[model samples]
Target: MEKPNSSNALVCELINKGTREWNINNLNSWFLPEDREAILGIPLSSSNTPDRLVWAETRSGKFTVKSAYALALEEKVHNTRADCSDESAGKIWKTIWQLRIPQKIKHFASKAARDILATKSNLAKRKITPNGMCDLYVVKMRKQSVICYGAVIMPKKFGRIAGSGVVIRDDAGEVFAALSKKWKSPLGAIEAEAKALEAGVNFAREVGIREAEFESDSVVICNALQGLVSPPSSVVNVLAGIMNEVSYFRQWKFAHVKRQGNVPAHLLAQHAKNVEDFVAWRADCPSLIEHACMQDKM
Candidate 1:
């Protein structure tokens, strides 16, 4: 007769061992004391010299028995139950899965994990880091005479585009969309961007909206928004005022996008720059920005 495979033999050996309160301590040594007790209960001490002990650790900073051996003991318990019939053996086997479910959930950085494991052997040379940056495309343009900035919004549904936005606030709160006017100089760009964010946040807040994500291509505005440095005199006080108004939001994230992607906002702003009097909305959009919206529909 052919020899039995090691896995099958091991299963059979475990079945023969049976559950007479087997050494759970060794199987759970890796888990914390509370987790160990939660899963395995207290160990059954024995006076006999032959009784064996072993232990292991768990992620929650506790010690428990080695998991595989505990699984072996659980398998033995179900196998030796007399009332469990031969035809019901598969059902009994499924019970072993219950013990392993929790242990299977741990996540790790895979490429880095492989690199570290490779160092323990003589097989490979490359050390890999599995982290990458979020690619940002910023499009900036003139609508009428206004300079606008924009970045794409990722949609909840996959493979789709949501609306985009111009960064109105840097450190104030969540990102929002708004209408802005054209500025001829660098100082103009900074003040205009800050005002746009303040306008957008106030509009959103009036409607009870909270939390937002904002992005911009202007490094000057971005750095100022983050409070990494001061904005020029024309913009600082307004930026600070906007921050106070937006302080109720849960969080705000500022991102920098490249200029090529900020086109839509640029178009809106360019249109707004020429208007004599600004109304926050025209047919649900700022009247100054209506031309840009109409052009987009076309």
Candidate 2:
């Protein structure tokens, strides 16, 4: 076969060495004069022998004439054979290792490999459980920075998914408003909840709603809003901007609610995920109710 590129010159040397270290008389024919010059730095001569070239060394610290390709091929064949064998080869390899390596280290290294494999396999799938303890949260938004929000949380289980909520008030504490939003995925939950809150506040502002009650099932979201938790990860910059813009809406409160009581928010989340094809107010959600009735019949 033709020699490999200059980058793979070592492999070429190995191949040539395997071919009985071609002698100058006949070997010169195997190589172009330029290649010979490149490898040996001179034209081949009648006196040049296999031994001279076979043991030559290069400036790059490589064996210029070693049978590297032949050896590599043999090594590949041996490894393939060993890998194909089962318990017999494994035991043999283990016995060889026992003779060569420290017993304590061998077991430790083997266990580490097994642990890596287990982790890799387990990562193939993720489990999602939606227990009723936590409720889903959703919100509607028009031009608010904090846009469509959603989350699921169990309020009674965790005191503060993130802290105390904000308090919005009118001239007196008696006339005030409170709002909070919660969700399932902690990272994305707060952003969605915040967006929902911003939308609600904006809507309230448009309608001149100065004093009202707004609550979210996401305690973590409330904590974030009240500066109880650290800044959220997913939508920090956006939520921060929303918070800054809502500074004028000081008459707003953030409160936590149990999942059971946050059905409206949960429905909104389902709506956000395209669970409901149409957005409208119906006493029984006839479309959903009808879909459920059909599923039961099936």
State which candidate has the highest lDDT: 1
Q: Model 2 compared with the native: what TM-score?
A: 0.31
* Model 1 misplaced regions, further than 4 Å: 1-187, 279-298
Q: Model 2: how far is 161 from its true place, Å?
A: 23
Q: For all the candidates, what are their Cα RMSDs to the real structure?
A: 25.2, 26.1
Number of backbone collisions per candidate: 39, 19
Residue 190 local lDDT, model 2: 43
Across residues 18-89, which tens digit of lDDT does each residue of candidate 1 receive? 332323344333333333222222211111113222222222212345655654664465345533356575
Candidate 2 residue spans exceeding 4 A from truth: 1-187, 273-298
Q: Could you give candidate 2's per-residue lDDT for residues 1-298 as a string of tens digits?
A: 8544332334334333432222333324344443332233121111112322221122222353344564466457545654626788688657756676444345444434333211212212110112223333422221111111233222334421211122233333221222233221222234445545544554445445554555555676667767887543333434454455455564556566554433323434343333221233212323432342233224
Per-model TM against the reference: 0.34, 0.31
